[model samples]
Target chain A: MTTMADRTDATTTVPTEKLTLARALTLGMRTALRHDPSVLLMGEDIGRLGGVFRVTDGLQAEFGPDRVVDTPLAESGIVGTAIGLAMRGYRPVCEIQFDGFVFPAFDQITTMLAKLHARSLGRITVPVVIRIPYGGGIGAVEHHSESPEVLFAHTAGLRVVSPATPADAYTMIQEAIASPDPVIFLEPKGRYWDKAEVALTPYGTPGAGLDKARVVRPGADLTVVAYGPTVHTALRAAEVAAEEGTSLEVIDLRTISPLDHDTVVESVRGTGRCVVVHEAAVSHGVGAEVAARVTEECFFELEAPVLRVGGYHTPYPPSRLEHHYLPSVDRLLDAVDRAMAV
Target chain B: MTQPDVLDTVQLLTPEGTRVADHRYDPRVAHLDPAALRELYADMVLTRRFDTEATALQRQGELGLFTPSLGQEGAQVGSAHALAPQDYVFPAYREHGVLHVRGLDLTDVLKQFRGVDHGGWDPAEHRVHLFTLVVGAHPLHAVGYAMGVQRDGDVATGDPNRDTAVIAYFGDGATSQGDVSEALTFAAVNQAPVVFFVQNNQWAISVPTSGQTRVPLVQRGVGFGIPSVQVDGNDPLACYAVTAEALDRARNGGGPTFIEAVTYRMGAHTTSDDPLRYRDAAEVAAWRAKDPIDRLRRYLADAGELPQQFLDDLDARAEELAVHVRDTVHAMTPPPAESMFDHVYATPHSLVDAERAWFRDYESALEDGSVR
Candidate 1:
């Protein structure tokens, strides 16, 4: 119901609206579809049902059935066809219903979608975007609430990115769609309802981009790195740390596959301490990669061993134990305290 | 387990060098004159020669691997020849006959086998996608591509050159794959202008077609609500007629069709596979007697359609291609080590760029004798 940006140019003053992350993503997809005729949306219930999370609420009616297709309930078919559609010059934005549901299409994603560009010797470019509502929170059970970003990040051909804020959700979706390579767009389902004043401008912002890591809050002591759902937890921990006279620099790694190594390395080089946080399991997750990179790049500048705060190396537990399973403000603070102790 | 008759499968040209008339599909291949039939015969012969040369190359350590389509040339060429220039093809790795029909350079295909490249030709230029090694995955791609063609308003355009269709080539083994089933469902629901060409070549490595399916593979398509048919895969005319009818129906917006070409694999699944361990020699001999090329050759020779000059010219062409494949493969070298870092992503990634820079430095250091 909120009126998105009416302005066409950068200089025109655009109004900011308080929007949920889900609404922001809907508006982002709408903006992209309006701008490019080639961009279309495909998924199970994305058309008339507006997606389970309602991320694609009204775009289907506006764009017509051809542009916003409600595909048959098959994950591998959704991704495999998207690859084919990409080959035929249509940039398809596919919505995988949930994070765990993406496994059905994992073979198509990891083998065909990821490797086509490289194996074809740069002859083919699949500008396809797979939007997965990821991360565990809420009261949902099993496949509905899961964090599967790291599974895709390990693949070379895919550009894996997760947006933290409503504004980021708005812009990053368009950026992911515009990318020539296939992208795994992980939307933090936990933060889908979180509201923020989003600048309803066109895709790319001057200073803020999709691939780079943004240093959200600056400090002189230790640095906290997180993405997607955990970024909020990291900020809350930073706020508490600030009141406690402990200056904690918080960096939101918008893109995970590329890692924004320069920004993380630069921040760690300056702060001399770093703690990586995520909602995925602790071992061999994003935290492990960040820790290894940080150690290799800033080993001499370290004040302590790089710490990681995340869920245990077990399947995401039931709702009753989810809070303990997921990285939280208290868990992040605990990691901070340990790093400070070192 | 009885031998299927004309009531079960479409047989246009019998293995004994005779043409069988069918009211429904006879019109489909009516345009193929004697010259066209000879050309189709030449394509099959050339495909077999290329397969033989590639197999020899693999044995000689020139190729890393080779997937031979020794007996399925009739199924492959017939289906491929039915395609329009605008029509796209998604082929399994063994579709050398389809590749030949699409006018792809055999030497370029050898690049993949020789380990010089993963895929050698530009798919866009030829309207043929790169060979898919993964079983049953490409059928979904074909359906998706057909969906794209539909969106482009290229279907049912009434203009032969404007309207387009897509064909996906997979085997009986791929029918059991979940992706293939999904592709059939999507194609039928969307009425995407695509054809599912299943070359039921009797085996998927060590397993027979019976292991992959309980009923006829054609019935698999019918179960998904797509129109399905069975054809004599050893008869090139039947393969062509059935595929042409399906493609026409697709281009005209009649929806998808599934054609199961019943055939046999005269060779092992690949160069590394030995058929002597799995199947009976008597079965091989029976299928060998029904050789697709021999069927066409006998038909042409008996019908006074085969000229001595044409046969000599065709033989020379096949030999020349074999020599070219051998010479090109023998001269191939591994691509530059730095090239490994290329094309991982179309856009630049910091990690790949950093690794490439490090590799360059390491190689230079080695050249300068600074480090090993």
Candidate 2:
């Protein structure tokens, strides 16, 4: 009998039949609209304009004006009114247009949307999904490239999700739209054009639900955990480590919330060490949580302390300094060596 | 007999209570009967009682802070009572009277103030939305709701049942916000069924109305092409009449109207504020002379609507309400620390998930000093 792994991942994986992260997201959103009648796509210039990135380019023609709404240029209005629509039984997916522009909506999201469900004692479920293209890479001017996940992660009653691979992007978005709770789907603009082989089968049938994590590459030496653009860097570093006879395990944490901790713990349990990485600053970033959790879950199982390799404690640097800002192949390889030494 | 009515700025019977009336523009006030007048009085007093009790609890370290609507009672209740059962209300932080009139429990307001929760009532249940601490954001919500009402086949023609008007309540300071202007423009252009109610309570936390606006506020609403009206907000009768008329017009598919309810602030802006530091004593005294509750009581007595026993009974009822509110506030308990991690996401967060795990290690380390 052919094993499940051989039958699915390695043998079934095809490179040419792949989708870009942006295209995958577009396809996933289109599929959701086709399925759920209540699902609406609304934001500044999302209708006839098709979004600043063309992420919603053809949606208006397919779904019509009411569902694919073009709202006034007000972020707070978009989010605040989306809450009202959710109250009236519409699954509103709001687009904040840009990262810097999202601040106007912060009060509504943090003070209102995040607390709406709990304040109602779960009597009312506000299942709004706010899609914001976040993080820096395009050498864009101020505000457009901020990694503001920490501000929102601190807020209760919200779900945060980000996808690094085209496959995960395709599947996680549909899952976020179908989710019962409010979700902030942060799409990495820097990785939108990046492509990878994405299995067309439903995630559970082919992989896991959007909320769960996936071990993209398996090994036994040490675990490297990362999400978004950093996942590619981790994979590249693993290849170099393999040449040196080091077996490094790699994990792609697609969902920022409800982390697939069991997988990380299992990896650490097997390898006896771990490395956490992200594009966000190391202080209070996603890796900090991973380091803490691995330390707690597999403290005895861990031979060395859980190490984090990420952006330094500062604003996203100029393009010249981005090489230093991001966790590069050298950075990931360095972290791997450190973990093994530990 | 020395009557306070002639000299009072806070006249209970007005739209020209001094009887110096310009008949064409003067509003009608005879609609309020003995029972209606009494009900309005009870609502104002009870709301004030609720406000005082909440503030006392906050001072006793039970709440984070309190936003008192002490002097704006007549405006809140007057407009709230005028609203139809189907008409919606969007309020700013100081709408404690609106909450009381709509039957929202005092504890619901406390949830937001105490930092225990954001808001504690169903907006659909009361047609009273959560109090917006962020200025002027909710008017757009009201405008959008009105737009939704328009899309729901609930506007135009002469059908009363086909129209559902939305009422947005804000303060003088909120008038300066971009969201408020955007809301007004949308309401006007769509001819959306909405009521823009601005409670000009003399001060926006020490910055008086003069600093906020150059023109009369009601006239400012008119610039957006919305029909505007000014009311003697200290007079409950005037408030009820003006709000009722505006709501009726909007419900009849007449589009949006703006009402600037000119009123005063009887107390400091909030628990952490001191009004004496900001404004002169004479100005505060001048506003006090127009106190809505006291003037209403004088009218009630002059009209033979109240016996001596009714006064005593009301006092006892207000005190009882105050005690109940105090006890409920004191009864509030802190939520478990895990609940913070629990509600952050509808789905679990990997970062939160990981951090929660890390926190566990720190907690355990503190407990037994086993994990370094």
Candidate 3:
């Protein structure tokens, strides 16, 4: 177990270790709980069952039932009670079992949790984090794989974020917990088991801030902006595009709301072309916002019009047809090629 | 469902202005002296005056809309008075009496209806939450706050001054919402110190109470493992006694209690609603006979507590309040358009700031004739 002293020491070179995104999330929650006495985890089956995805495995035993609560199977109740808990100065991290189940608690999240701080004129702050596993490619049944990040991102008074890698997953979760406002933390379900080397320490750093977008793979030809599950696809697409003589700069948008447009605009100006990709529907999605902002800021510098590649404007199709429904690496590459052609 | 039994409803004052007695609740009633009784009566009267003035304001186009708490004064005033200063209140939109009893400025309450502010008063200062427009949503918030009180060791403490209880106010229609049932379940599981006050005014817009539930609304709490009772909402003494007892049990480590205040909405649902289209005039007349204010006034007169001078003074005070509301509402100025972006987040956001700056520039450019 690493102590706070060792974790904060910049002089110490901590050994990097490989961990899956799920394990990293668990570690992040543990770190938050250790850091603040007000921090608590609330969800159905989060205790005895360790959550459906096992992202919260062993946390109940380690932190005790008081900290890791197994609430009744009601999404609205989970969020509503979390709001009350937050009002009493407790930082509650609530987990929705699946992306599709989030609708049951939408009223509590959007109406109550989102607006409380603003309605109270900042006197009352809802420091609650709602963790949702979203996006398709899991081969699960209906209602299991769906990306609804756009709904919350569009709503004011809410900060929506998603961590695409293990290192970011470890740091961003804690940052979300630390936020004084309510946060809708969307986790990419398909990338839960994806592993990468992560430094267990060095949080709250300038580069590790929750709202900053990182250029994971730098290039000069065209800029590709993506988040969550699509970030992996975009990175993979960039690798494949390199062999085909296209240098694609890939940007992982950590925060959906309060978008790091400075970084995106700078990258777009460098490349003079942009492509936004996501798993949500193409119509009125985060991709649309990114495309609009890029076009608005980099109008004169653009060699081509900003393009977007995303899921079709339809309900999440059956698992068998989800591969065709979700944005694939080939589809992303096609958009990149179109931008380059223009 | 069978009609609600007259005897099943708890009452200390009858519809005919007779004072009755309940062995269980009479002691609590006895604690209130003549001055306290007059004060409670004045609160109900003043609240009604405020409601009437606001309604007239809305009709005259001085305000946008109004939701009058006409016939439900007994339940709102009695229950609000029962709360200690430390106790928090989570109220639905039609809680004019509750707001008055909490000592909130009437002008502040009118500001929202006047289209000046969303909620004009600070909830923290008053220990009363903002008026929640979303039905059945605030009960969950109240229950959650009660859970926090439990965790903070505010309940079961021998010190009554420090022990806290939360009262959640909702309506008959709100009981049908899933969030209300979810609130009950959460409160029961946590054994939180909360009182679920349901004002069953017999209508959810055009839908009747029958459409909301087949059984009496009070029984909804029983299935959730909460002890509940039905009260004659027109009887102020009964409302006070029942709520006082419930709050006592909650602050003393007893779990949640649900109180169903049987009343009627004697006015339209709002300025926009026409209640006459759905309900008969005869039904309205029947509920008018059991008016909460008239019943309280009759009881005070019969008890010899309402002298001619006292009645005259109360009338004068009510008129004064109406004038104050009118003047304050008329004096309110619209907030700057840019103020909307101020409180969206506790911390600064780049987008909000940038948008605010852009709007400022746009306004200045239009003033300078640089752009339209």
Candidate 4:
């Protein structure tokens, strides 16, 4: 049970393991808990039930009850108490069950956790990590599939990041836990089962390129920016566009708040065209920020104005209509076509 | 009409300067001698003087606003006095007496109200957190902190100095808030060492207690499986006795206790409010008759503990404190504009850093006539 602590900074020769994004997160938290005696996990039904999505499976049996707490069914209480625990020198990782249900704790997250360090003039640091399962591809009912990441990224005091692959999940969760600032860790619930080879040993420090953008595919015709669930769609679009003799590059924005604008600008400078994709509504969403920044920095290099592919400006429709609501590969390719035509 | 009375309101001293005894709590405060009682009186008087001075400062446009703790001194000071130095305090906005008892400087309280900084005090140094303006939000933090104390092996320890507890001060209106109820649930389940002290000052701005809760606020705690008691907030000795017992229970790992200090808001909610717009003059007059400072003064004078020299010296000290607060507030200056960009995040944030750099360049441009 405690053996995970000794394996954290061990040799990097550990074989890569094929694991789901959810399992990678559990392993990351397990590694953090074992490495730092001060780290603890708290959320509703996180102990015996192993969380509704089984993201925290088998943790309680391993770490016992105190370190892996099953808190009361109160979102505000979970985050509020995590702030206090952070104040008491404990790094608490809190799990808000769903993205839509996170509004109940929004005041605590935006007002207290985000602003406490600044309010106290650096005398107090709330090193709390809020893990929210976000995005809309699961075909679940309302409140289960929604993207509320933009609301948190808009807040100045929080560090917002989402992992699109199992490998990123394995490392980013630990990075969020080790951060001195409060972090909003948005796990793409849509991509929870996405499998990838994750390194079992420490690869880098917490902040070493954890927030930087990654160029997933390289080309010269156009640049397509995406994150979380949309990253996969953009890659698919690039593959389809390649068959038609159009060279499209794809970039994954891992961090949302302190956006990696440098990478996006550099890619667009070469491609001379840009398209941003996301699952959230197109109005005032992450795509808007990406489009605006691309136009600001790559204005002279762009052949066409940056276009966006995302959900329409309406509430998340029923699960039956989700296929139409979510941004798909065909829709992203259509935006790439528009950028290339201009 | 006045608020309805609860039959179980604890009272160790009456408004007419008479002392009452209860077997359960009387022993808790029986150790206090004449000197200690006079000190308690002095605390209440000085706290009231500070509130009065702050209110005047707001009127004279020296401060943006002030939340006066004029009538709830007994509730704030007595319970605050019961806390050990190791115990932490999470206070609401109107806890001037608690801040005074916790050794927070009077000028530090004015910093936030004067539109300077959010709060200038170091919470770790004083073990008292910044005042939470959002009602009912901080009790959960207090509960979480107490859970941390329990995990640190600081609870139920026979060593008195090592064992610690946390107290969260809120008001009656906060009981309706979901966060406060959740705090009670967490504290009860974790068996955390905490005391939920609700100062039922009978008004949340213009709304009365009836608007907030149907039953007494004390009964609200019992529904959450916590032992609760109501005390006369005007009686300093009763407030002290009840709070001391609760703190001892919490430190000994007996779980949380909710104490409802039934008090009044003799002044407006803040310097910006006009209480006369909603309440009758008769209601204000009735509460004034139960003035906490006058009742304590009468009890001391009756017991021959308050000599003429003591009274003269106390008045002089109160006047001296008022002068010091006024001078300190006047002398205060706003911080540099660039300092606002500091401490947003402990780690370097690229967005904030870029904005700060741009602002510095902009300020330089203005000075050098580049932008113009």
Candidate 5:
């Protein structure tokens, strides 16, 4: 990377940019809005209030009220009407204000938005995008930080995507907007402010294949599959393992609906051991799915059982306890260590 | 503006073919034609027949569950019919009667409860919003859509033909939701052309209306600055007249008006719940006397619009619809298992895709490893 304030040198050509991941998201949204006429954003306090996190700052003024709508303080109203507006050919993007507040719209997403296409036998498609900032890290009060993506993943007829990097966030968001199916785009709030260089392009230009999983780090000793905020944590654990000469593999599963099994299976086959980590509770969490898939695809190749490290089956812990609740660099490497021992 | 709706509440022709006229509600012969009354009576009978049939099927294990609207038929059908072709309707889950009026097929409505589909109708094509499972949420959607329609210059605006209004139907328990109150406030302030239809069928699951509110629920409308009224929900004509006028004024730029249809729950909340635990038989019997269909049938027969043959044909027609619905439910093939992971988000997701693949594998293994 080229020289920058945060990391003066990492590579030759690419520059180490010093911008918060949240600002990158804001800029990416602004660019997407300016680039496409169909793109419109609506949510509570997202207009004049500039959103609770100010991620939507200056968007209403730039896009105007009609495009950047300040909807009534009703989550169900926001989603149900977005389905109506989507029918009218407006590419309406909705924000749930917070993760806990999204349940009111769950019926609309799981039942209406999800099944509209399948029930209509593919005649009607709901391209509406729902954005929820998820995962606990910040000291924000309860109800603001939750990982409800697992529930959405259980729903039929909906796609769930969470981006862990500013680079993926910039692209995946535009991809979500352009998708024909309803997409639940969960932003890893814990990683929102961390900086990275993001490659920007025209909105709706799908970069990562809609269903393919991405391998964040290539290794041989063990494969660690993780998503959302946990992906970064897994990568950090991989760094620790590298110092110990363990050569750990890391996969960032950006998509949750149609599993990108080819990439995941490929990585698992390369590495003899496997572990899946997530912020969602482990009991029937996304990790359970990944572990089962790895067992199915690479049973004989796996020298160890498919292990999972995740949050406890309880409410997301308080901020002071979140560090303990969340799968950390140490816990992940420990899971990796256990897998290697097997 | 401080008083109740000045319009009449019709109470004519009981089940025994007798007519009664009161000071406030003189039966509106002006609005009713011979054919209209007969059709109205037929609508009520057939919908109730369908409701009863669905409940029986649920009990027999033919369907998953049923939310019965046995007593609220008149309130739903009457108010739904009042809408112009352009006006939109937003309904709570127990709105079989309204869906029937809006021409949604029985097969589609049943698919929802059968767990075969999330919902089976397109809101845009039918000019109705989705059946909101979340209590009281649809009113906000109805009102917001009305605001949109108004912004599009589609309100009644004293030009009767050009006005468009929205009707939101929810139950008494749903009124406790903050969304319901917020919807009324927004509709009132923006003067959105919308009507709030609350079918106070009394019990919200185990909780009675008394537990929720001390005042008449209709009066709560005035607190929000929206005019309000309480009507005998079992009276078909009263429900029709009140809803029609409210929709009329809404279309004519008269902001929002709340109509509280005072009715009783003749059946349990759903197939799973036992109402006997909470309600007494005496209360159910008292309300049974004011049954909406019997009174409408009496009015029609007395007016010479309904014949004995009409009653027989109605019975045959109801049974025919029931049989047809039953066949559709049983015939519905379980949607493909992968169909579960297909529609969570509007866009394809890497995380969801991975999980779906994972579930698909485990499911396949559980069923038989050979199945793809």
Candidate 6:
């Protein structure tokens, strides 16, 4: 049995290591549990199975059943109970096994969890972090592949964020746990095994905040913005665009709700064009919100209209046809090509 | 499977106002002094007055709507008084008596119905949660809070003052909701210290209790492995005794207990509802004969505990409360328009701040005639 001390020694000694997004999330939960006694993990199959994606792998063994609870297969109960636990002054990190399964808990999440803090007039703080693995790419059945980030982001009280890389996943999960407001942490399932070097140490200062966009790749021709699983596709598209002398900047919108409008507007003004990409449905999706905002804010600076590349207005197809349904590198480049046409 | 007989309900005070012995629950009520009984009676009387006045206010177009607990006063008051101050309560919308017993001002309770605030009182201060309008949703919260109480080492402490339990109050209709079933499951599995108080008031808006479940609600808890009892809800003494025992058992780490307080809704589901369209007058007359307040009044009178002066003073007190509710409800004003954006999140978000600023500008623009 690896004791807490031994685990700490191992993490501290390994200053930086290449870890997958799933492993980084596990490390983040571990850090949260070690830092605060109030932190708890609850979900179906999250305890014994370490989650279907193994995002919470080995956490139950280390944290004990009390802290890492395996709940009954009821999404509403998991989230509703988490609200009550939050009211009792515990920071509960709830895992909604998959994105599509979140609908069962939607009433609890949107009505009670999202509205409780405000209804109490700040007397109560629902410090809950709801982690959902979202987006399509994995050849899985229905209900497993979906990008429902916009549903939470549109809600007033919730703070919605998605992390593409392992390093940001490691840091942002802890930040979401530490936040006083309820946060919807959309984990990119397709990127779960994609590895990158992550600093074991904490990022930024204590309470440095997590609602900001990051410029992953710099260019001057046009700004290509994406988040979560689609971020890598945008980066690859940017690379492909670079070879053709078309300088395409890539911006990873870490926070979806607040939009980090300043960073996005500045980038768009610099490039004079913009293209937004997401895996959710095109109409009223996060991409649409971004397109609307960019059009509103950087209307005068735009050489071309802000374009959007996203899933068609249809249900997430079966695994066999998901490739055709979800946004791809070629689709993003085609949008970029249209932007350059102006 | 055969359904449990409805007559198996536990009763201490008969509908005729006669006190009777309850073998299982009498011990819990043995400690209630004359003063406590009088206090319980006063709680019911004042709560009824408050509820009636709120309903009248709604009819007069002063408030948006009102849900009256006119007939279930005994159940709410008795169960609420049975709880200790440290205990937490998750109330469904029609818990006026419970809120009053928990020390919430009548005017504060009316704020939500008056369209002034969602919930005017702070739950942390009173240990009473805000009214959950969604039926059966709060039981899960109650169970979760009980689990937290358990985690805090607040149960099985042997000290009655330190140990805590949670009570979730929902109507008979809520039993059909999936959340309530899940709550029972969670409460049983965790062995959490909680009391599931189902006031089987025989009506869920327009639908009758028969439509909700074929078996008695008490039996529903038994299936979930929770010890359950059915009490004559009109008998405050019985309600008090059963709830006290259940809460005690829970505080002592005895796990969850379900108490189905058998009662009736003598009024419409809400001020907006019309009972005449669905039910007959004979049914209302039958329940009126078994009025909880009248039975209690007869008991106090027969026991020689009530005097003419005391009865008159109680009437005057009820009138005073009615006036207070009416005046305060009328005096209540809507909060500032910009205040709507406050408390949406614990910390400030640029989006909310921007929206608040835009609203302020829009309001100012309208005031100064900048645009139509």
Best by DockQ: 1
> How would you encode candidate 3's per-residue C-alpha lDDT over B1-372 as one tens digit per residue?
323222378998988878887788999889798889899999999999998999999988999888999999999999998999999999999988999999998778777788877777888888998876888898988988898898889998889899999999999999999999999999989889999999999999999999999988988888788888899987888999989988988999998988999999999999899998999999999999998888878887888889999889999999999999999888888888878887898777788899999999998999999997
Which whole-number lDDT from 0 to 100 does residue A33 have in model 4?
A: 86
RMSD (Cα, Å) for all candidates, in order, is 3.0, 6.8, 2.8, 2.9, 6.6, 3.3
Off by over 4 Å in 1: A1-8, A203-207, B1-7
TM-score of 6: 0.97
Evaluated against the true structure, the overall lDDT of model 3 is 0.89
Off by over 4 Å in 6: A1-14, A202-208, B1-7
- Per-residue lDDT tens digits of candidate 1, residues B58-114? 998888889999999999988888989999999998999999999998788888878
- TM-score of each model, in listed order: 0.97, 0.83, 0.96, 0.97, 0.79, 0.97
Q: Where is the poorest 10-residue window by lDDT in model 6 chain B?
A: B1-10
* Preferred candidate (lDDT higher): 2 or 3: 3
Candidate 4's residue-wise lDDT over B1-372, tens digit each?
223223489998999888887877889888999899998999999999999999999999999999999899999998988999999999999988998988988779999999899977999877999876888999999999998999899999888998998999999988889999999999989989999999999999999999999888888778777888899998889999989988998999999998999999899999999998999999988989898888888898899899989889999999999999999999889898888899998878888988899999999999999996
Q: What lDDT does each candidate get? A: 0.91, 0.78, 0.89, 0.89, 0.78, 0.89
- lDDT score, residue B370, model 5? 62
**Once superposed on the true structure, which residue ranges of model 4 sit more than 4 Å away at CA?**
A1-12, A203-207, B1-7
- How would you encode candidate 3's per-residue C-alpha lDDT over A199-276 as one tens digit per residue? 887543323676789999999999999999999999999999999999999999999988999999999999999999
- The lDDT, on a scale of 0 to 1, for candidate 1 is 0.91
- Judge candidate 6 at residue A320 and give its lDDT: 91
Quote the lDDT for B121 in model 3: 82
TM-score of 5: 0.79
Candidate 5, CAPRI quality class derived from DockQ:
incorrect
Please provide, for model 1 over A3-56, each residue's C-alpha lDDT reduced to its tens digit, 9 standing for 90 to 100: 122323677677799999999999989988998888999999998899999999
Q: Which ten residues in a row have the lowest lDDT in candidate 1 chain B?
A: B1-10
